[model samples]
Target: MAAAIERLLSEISESEDPLEELRSLRTAVSETPLSGLRESFSAPQLRVIFSLLNTNDKEQVEVCVDVLERVLQVLDPTHLVQNCKSELQSGLNHPDDSVKVLALSQIGRVVSHAEGTIEVLNNPEILQDVIQSIGAERISVSKEAIATLLKLSNTKAGLDGLFHSDLLKDLKDVMAISDVIRYRVYELVVELSLVSPVCLEYCANSRFISQLLEELTGDDVLIRATAIEMVTNLAQSQHGRQYLAQQGIMDKISNMIIAADSDSFSSFYLPGLVKFFGNLAIMDSPQQVCESYPAFLNTVFNMALNPDPSLTPVALDTLGLLGGTVEGKQVLHKTGDQFKSVLKRMSQLARDGATDLRVRSLEAITQLLVLPVEQQTDDLLLLTESWFASLSSQPMEMIKHISTQPFPELHCCALRIYTAIACQEWAQRLMMSTPGFTEWVVDRSVGKGKEAKDCKFELVGALLSSPSTREIFGAQNYLKLKTYLQEGPYYVSAVSSVTTEGAD
Candidate 1:
């Protein structure tokens, strides 16, 4: 295949009108395996092919780019772009809009290959050409220009050029004037945000957030939801939220959540809206946010208890998001009985062939069971036991599936519940008789589990919290349990003395 492609390239190079030969080459190249293409073309030969893209014929330009796009799978970008720059710049100015747009898209691919190359984006002439094309009357030129600018934004040199030039302001103007351009602009902003959080600060300070937030209030739910995501990213910094709050944007987001909630919230944007406010609620502070804790808690609970299993996961996630705060923790504790009921019902659903529900059941259990001791009680333990019973009744293969899932938090919850039950001597003895009970207890105590490690403090606290656990473990398992509970200054000194020669 390499021989054939090479022979065809030689034939095409010798032809008076290589366009016809190049057209044939495309078919042959496509059929020829990619490895063959790479093997057939040396760097010099590939450079020659890229150089042909400068032709006046649009067909020749397209075929050249198409072939390079394929060859790029193996060709190095430094060599590819060095030879193709003039050709691409010429193609970008082609009379045919399709040719121009395709050239721009291909440029993105090429620049992506040479990702860290500053020289590609640093060329003053190329930057000016792209900026001029951005203001072109033709939509294709405009789109290509936006794409190229986005690609340019990939390099620091490109970003430096954009900062020095009027590109940012121009892109903003185009975004304001054209709906087609606005989506691309917002998307570019989001993409840039990953590389630089400061990029979001620019978006927030610019009219972009205001424009996006205005769309959130619009009738189009899709736009509203997208705007919500855009705002959410921007709100990641405290300054971003303060900017929103100053502009009364938080009130708008809160209102949108309430308004969106009045209906089913089954739209694509609903999740983003829910997440945005959920983030805002936690980030801004619980007591200060105009919304009351009970109202927010009830709303989340309703969503958790919804018939749709999908809502349960996000609701559980929201609870986890809020779970980090003191107020949120206190609220979950205050509503312990309600959470227990939900857990009981979810466990029943887990038994009734709703595998997805069971997955989310573990998630909710992770959040609830990891709550403070004021949140834990005998009722919660009963709910946990019922879920375990359901899980244990499953076939061995199904049990393996449950074991593989990533739920370190769920494991911690299990340990804490184990500690709770272990505090009761009768229950501890009963659990000891259960299948694989000893291994499970040891695993929870000092095993290779995240929650296992986290439960260390809780283990000591639980043992010391209950007179029975202290007396029982103190009598029989004191040394072992003390070894497990060895943390903090006192334990550090004790362990250090044991290790020191002649110190004891």
Candidate 2:
């Protein structure tokens, strides 16, 4: 393999065309790890290959950058970067935008661990070069440049260094040039915000905030959504939210979305608009939240009925949160037609043939029950009939199926709902009539600990925890069931306790 790699390196060095040489090297590296190939090349030969990154021919430079990216795999990236700094600087200065982006791309890879990489950490200009690339004329160049900056910002040195530079102005310069670059840069800004309080403060620049607010109502759908999301990320911090509210962004959005004329602006983007305010309302004072979202619930309700599967889940989540608030509950009660329709929609979704969607719909219904009246009223019959009525008029078979669900949360949640209904007098008779309910509780509850896949202990625990349902199980085997429950985790909680991170 050493001799074969040496032969390939010799062929690469002698090739008349650098692109052709890179092509041969790419194939060799793919078949043999670059580690294996690096040992065969003498130091001088490696420099010759690395020097191709400085080639003024843009296409060959791209190919060569691709080669350097692979070489860094087996070679010491920090060492190679320092050794080839002059060439990389030349690549950065190349007039062709592609070479500049590719150079920044490589720099991004090299400075990835800024704590240890003296070439970038010790040098301020290397970080400046990355920031300057953000203002490149071409979008691709700036996009890669932003990605480069994102990688740098993740490092401790990068964090300490980026917050100190005139990064805000350079990022604003990119945002001013193109909406495409604007959002991409904002994503990097959000990352930088996570690292430092000063960076988050810079992101609150008045001019930048004004532009983001203006873009919130822009003619373009993509631009509007981008603006909303940037605001969302910033809202993650309390100071960030205070800055946003000081700008009156929350009120501006509330007025704009509530305006009858704003439908054209928001119809396609209702999900984003709903989410923007939903997030805002959650973060603000309860009195302010109560006064702010009176008109938006109908739009969210409509989203529940919209056939777009992806939108439906987020919309349902928003609705569930809305229903939890004091004002949102009143809104649901005031608009019973809309409220029941949503319940009916959730019920239908719970019964859908798709298991995953069924799980989501069931969970959403559980969130709705946070509003006590909704649960005590129509939602009660609707959910029970949707999840349980299919197997029997009761929950015995329904609870059994739930206990065996692949996801433990589903078992925990569905049974919690089933438990609510089971405490009712009629539900007791339903449990008494079902044979599978007894078998699952007694066999799994008191039987040996647990098995490979199936678990029903959470369900068993739920049943025994309740006085009404416990009576239905009869008192003869009470002590045995009690002893089994006392043992470590029942199957359901036991399975839930297992963390699968890094498992085979």
Candidate 3:
């Protein structure tokens, strides 16, 4: 193909009938497989091809243009951009208006992909041509040019060139032009702002943020959703947050959440809304977080307290995600007796016949109990004692049902909570009642086995912490665990004798 095209170019450059030779070459180039053709053509071949493409023969020029685009990946990849620019400028001057527009759009793509392309794009002459192409009355040409500009704006250097080349204000013009290009422009704003925070800082005081925020209330769901997402990113930055908060966006979003309307849950706004509030919790100070806690907690608590069980789990999980903080814990404390009421309610739900509700109820109870002792009172001890006594008499079948359920998170929570309570006496009572329970715990704790290990590690931890339980663990019933502790992992034996002799 390269030899054939070279022969044809030579023939066309010298023939008495150049047009005929150009026509024949156009046909051959059109028939050539684009992939194989690019591999064959050198940079010189492309320059000669571009030279012939600018000829008066429109069909020859058009075919060359089509083939040129398909072969772009195989081109110099960066150099010889000036040749394409000159040819495009010549094509733009053609008598045929469609030919002119095609030339302009093609020029944009070439420049967009060109290495060292920024120099050409930033030139006042080329910048004017790009803007003129975008504003052309021919909708197809104008749309193509605008789309190309938006894509070009995605690159850091390209965006920087635009900012320096009067392209920024020109982008605002394209953004104001409606239709599909509007979304493209909106996305460009987001990309542009995200890529360069310095650009965003500069644009922060501009009308762009206001324009985008106003779109949040637009009737179009996509626009609202995009606006929410944009606000989310913008608000995450300290500058963005300061800007939105000054605009009263914080109050507006809170009210929107409270309203709980259809628009808030629409495809575009829902994730944005959740992210917005979630980010708010992250952004606020502990004091500020505490101040807003009651409103958030009451809203979630009422939803959890509702008669329909379906919303309870979703609301519980959402609330957990939202209030996962010390300040949130403070909110729970401030709710006073209401907090106690919710705990009792969870206990009731845990006792309910529905397994799913019981699981969620158990989780909520675990969350409340996992807090520090300073955060709770002895009232919870009575509650646990009641549940423990009930479990002690329950059938083995019932115990299996509780233990076999595959909630590892719940199991870990149970381990931590139960360990917190398992003083030596309580542990002895547990072992006596369950028989081989310490062995079960040890097997699970230490082995590849599903059960726990029986070691003095558990008993020692329990005994040292609870004075009464220590006295009970000193007796014969716990002798095996006591022996294991003397022989095992903690080297409790290595320290125990010296400590015991001192005490003696």
Candidate 4:
């Protein structure tokens, strides 16, 4: 094994195809036991592998990094920091972004240990190198550098090293590079803030959150769009939400939505703004958000009617998210005629719009209509039933026709819609009243693919699980439906004994 390692190293230095040599070394190092690797691999030999990162070939650099990660796993962490530290630091300072990424990755691996974290954090030059790499021209290098910094932040010593020193100042300098890089740093800040309230406090103190919030109302619509997304991410946590609310960021966003109606370039940032409020609604109380910001619901309904392809889907998705909760459903239901118009539009889009629009519209309808057994109140049920009725004169037949389409995604989505409503008494009555609908439910071959089959099984399970099934379908049909559920989604009879099959 030692001789083989020597031969591969020699080939890597001499061979015209060093990538092949690197690949061979990667496989060798991965398969060999740690003991065998330690006996054969020396520190100088690993440095030689590290030198491969200087190469122009991206694939070769990747293979070299891969081999080093495996070999480094077996080596003592102290030895790596003591011996290989300079080599990795050079890689980080290397002019080539690929080399920098390779180095950042190795440092990331090292910093996963307590001692390695302390060592890297103590070295100002190496630490600065990693932070500056966040602004690298190549996104891959920037991403790796950000990942390394995130790993460092995971450890107490490393976290203090970052937040206690000129870390924020360095990050602020990096943000001056470009809007693209700025958002990358913002992403890191948002991620770190989510770690704990203490980490969030560090982020807030750094003024990074303030800078991010300012970007929302900034002149650049694209930046405003980008900024809102990060702000939305920060709002995901309880403390973060409290912080943003304290700043009146929600109300400010509400004002932006109202102002968007007159802005010609609103399309650029409008979707993100709607999504922020949508997520905010779902995260907090839907009733509270909608009641607090009537413009949010109003804009969503308007965007749904808008012909701009980009805006409509966002609006549909936001609607779906808002309707996922009981409060959200009630909020929409209370919109009355305004909500009815939106439902009418959604029904049309579900049948005749683009594939994505159709799917999203169906999903929104399902979220609005489906009620969990626990949350099923008389008022909510009536609201869902009314929404379903308002969808079309024959909502069931339209969805059934959609299920017949060849696309498996549409088929599965349609089945999910049925499953969502299968337990409702009004839905059950409609199924019984509709021609061949009950037979369609029990038909094993009605849908194709594993997902569609699973969805069909769920629908049957929902029906059988419902209290009204025995009374609604009668004992005979109820037994047949129950047997279908028991047989499972993928069940098939060995003998083909179909009395009749429904039309595709």
Candidate 5:
């Protein structure tokens, strides 16, 4: 085995045309036992091996990269990075695309899970080589280049370096080239656009924006999602959202969404459809909202009201997003009282026995509370009263959630809805004045459950402080309420401190 490696190395080092020698070196590495291969490569060998990357022969670099990929899989890459960093850096900058691809593929593995690779991987000149490879002629090289960028982006420092690099301009050039390559670059674009507003601006007016939206209607699920995701990122900004609406983006997106099975949410386009509209509604116009997604308001509510539990929460979420922005509220109220029916359905979801279903429902209702008054039901008081009607039994349910999850997310959600009600003045008054509700709040706050475990401490404090408490309890009863809070040892509690501050 040593003789074979020695001969192949000698041939690769000595030959004027080393293509055959490169192939022989690969054959030697593969034929060797795993331990033998691990022992064979070092700084001296790597310099000789990597020298071919700078050669004019593409086939030599191609075979060398392919061989290194397989050999590195069987051995610790520390020897490669620690001893031959300069050789690898040279490979990244080599004129040969295959050399750049293979070196980066190796770097991707090294930087991701290993410590101390930050300095080697984040070199500006080297990073520019990786970025330049995004435009490589071969799709495999470009894909590996993107994979390396994403792995490097795992660190905050690397992400910062990438965010400031002027090389991202080539990304548009990359986007115009190949669908297979775009798939890889889209992941980095998503990461960059999410973190930097500057990248978001670049995403807005780029010519490839239309191509991305067009790809949504194509046969590939992942491509459609990536494209819509780019649109979604743009939609996150007020200017971007309005720009999409103006540029007829909604026309393209709506048609794609219409192609999806809204009833069966597991359909390929469902997630992108949901996420895109979520951002679309953020700052868009009423005309834009109504024209793009007609009758979706009716669709989501009907799905949420469906007996099948699976679709209810997602449908409820999409419904809330339709009312998410100022104009979205106008679009929602225009749906008529088929809309009011959604409120009842959301209430049903809040009371659902399934914890996740219930949490999503409460989130939807919480969103509803923020809509403009003219764009809401004429009878919010009735809705609030009805919410209290369903909520009256929830104290016991909150306690039930504690033991169900080791994490307490369900428990915390129930408490969130309970607190959501407490924070609103009208809802707080209605619940406190209701017979037995105030007493339950007091019990939940100071009685049995740990103070941290319970949710209603503030509502009880608010009632005792409100001048209108004379209606819920006579002035005599109101005085006792303050006394109970003050002397019951719940006063100095953390809940009491927050509750007292909110009332004052």
Candidate 6:
């Protein structure tokens, strides 16, 4: 094993093409047992691998790092810090950003374990180098440095090592370099806080949470936008939601949305703010969220009506998400005339708007109309039917017309809307009454593309699978539809012709 390691190291140093040699070294090192590696691996051989980092070739350097990390995994904590720590720390200060990234990545791997974390914590210089790397001019290096620090915070000992000392001050100083860097560190803090209650408490005590909150409500629209996104992520967990609620952050965001109408640049952060509330509504109770913050639903409706291309799609998406569940559909249904007006606007967009807007509108309508079989009640069914009616005087024809358009996206979306309503008795009746509508669904030639075929298949399947289909659709048509469904979406019919010899 020792001789093989020596031979690979020598070949790497001497080969004109070191990448292949380095790859060989990596494979050899990885396949060797850790016990054998521990006994045979020496500082000299480690330095030979480290020397590869000095090169300009990125692939070679990466391969070299992979080899070093494999060998580092076998070393006990004592030997790791004693022999390899200095090499990695030196790589942090190397002129090559790739080397810095390599160094930080290996440090991250080292600190992933308890013993490695303890070893790293004992060495303040190594810790300081990592924190300083967060300010590296290259974004990649800075990101890696932040990741290394995040790994350090995974264990309790590592967490204490980070927050218990002045190291965090170093992190703060680097965060001042730019808003981009600041958010990177902020993301790291939020991730750590999510680890446990104790970690969140540590972050709160460090004033990180307060700083994050300040940024969330700050005057700089861009900063506030970024901050609100992070806070929204923080609000995903029950603990996070609880903490934000206790801090009154949720109310503050709601008020921000309420005040957005007066702010000239509200468009900058309005989508994110709306999305935050949209997610909050979905995560909690749609009824409670929309009722408590009437501004949320109103803003969504207003945005849907607004002509700005940017805001309309987001509003459309949020409405679709809110209407995806039974509770959500009920909440929107309760809005009565206001939601109906929004539905009218969505229907108009689905027909006459830009292609993208048309697709989003169709998707939103589908979400609003779709209800699972088990969850379907007469009220819900009637509600969906009414919403479909509100779309157009002839909603089925409008969507069927769309399905024939050249745009595959619009075609699939229109078919999805059909599928959404296919299981309902009124919808099935509408299809029967509409000329050639049932034939169009079973005919594979009408739709193109995998998505379109699948959607048409689903629509047919919905018709055949519904409880009342046999009564309304007739047995002959049902069997034909059943044959279509049996062959699946991608089925191509086989054609044959017999040719008699010399029979012209």
- Whose TM-score is greatest here? 4
lDDT of 2: 0.62
Model 1 lowest lDDT segment of ten: 488-497
Off by over 4 Å in 6: 1-6, 11-43, 55-82
Name the weakest run of 10 consecutive residues (lDDT summed) in model 4.
495-504
TM-score against native, each model: 0.56, 0.61, 0.48, 0.91, 0.54, 0.90
Q: Clashing pairs in model 4? A: none
Per-residue lDDT of candidate 1, residues 1-504 (tens digit): 666678778877777678877877788888877767666787666656766765688778788767866776665556655666676676667665655665566566665644524556555555555655665568667767767767766665566556545656666665665564676667666555444545555555565656777887777676777777888876777766766678887666656556656666445566676677678777777545524424445656776777766566667677666654556555555565776555456555433435555555555444433434454556555543443443344422233344444555444444554554455444444544556643443344243444446565565555555555545444545545555565521232333434667875
**Could you list the CA RMSD of all candidates, in the order they appear?**
12.2, 9.8, 14.0, 4.3, 13.5, 3.1
Please list the C-alpha lDDT of all candidates, in the order they appear. Answer: 0.59, 0.62, 0.55, 0.86, 0.61, 0.86
Q: State candidate 4's TM-score.
A: 0.91
Candidate 1 pairs with clashing backbones:
none
Can you write out model 3's per-residue Cα lDDT over 1-504, one digit (the tens) per residue?
Answer: 667777887876566546666666666677777766666666665666566655676776666666555555455534545545665566555555565566666656655674635656645565555655554556666666656565566566765676655766776776666645555555545544654566565455445667777876777776776677777777666766776788888777666556554443443454455556656665765346436633445545665666666446654554444334445545555666665555555555655536677666555443433333343335444443443444334422233344444654334333433454455233346544665555554342332223223322553454444545445544553565455555654332233444555574
In the predicted model 2, the residue pairs found to clash are none
Model 5 per-residue lDDT at 367? 58
lDDT for each residue of candidate 6 in 221-335, tens digit (9 for 90 to 100): 9999899899988877778888988999888988999899999989989999899888998899999988988888899999999989889998999999999988899999888
Candidate 2 residue-wise lDDT, 1-504, digit = tens = 566657767877787675776776666666776567667555566677766665567777666666656665565567657676766666677777766875787787787765334567677666666766776777787778778777776655565556545654555665676666677666776655655566566545425555666787787876777787787777777777776778887777667656633455455566676787677666664335645555566566777787767568767777667655655555555665666777667666655525666667666655544323334445444543343344334435544565456655556556555544443434556666766555555564433324411234454454566565556657764555566567635434445557698987
Error of 5 at 146 (Å): 7.6
Candidate 5 local Cα displacement, residue 103, angstroms:
13
Q: Per-residue lDDT for 1-504 in model 4, tens only?
A: 667777898888777668887888888777778878876777887888887777678788778778876787777766787788889888888776666876788788778888888888778678888999988888899899889988888877887888788875787888898888899999999998988888888888888889899989999888888998999899899888898989999889999999998999999998888888888888889999899999999999998988888899998998888888888888888888998998899999999999989999999888888887778888888988998888889889988999999988889888888888888888889999999999998998888889889888888888887898899998989989989988888998897655656745
Ranking by lDDT: 6, 4, 2, 5, 1, 3
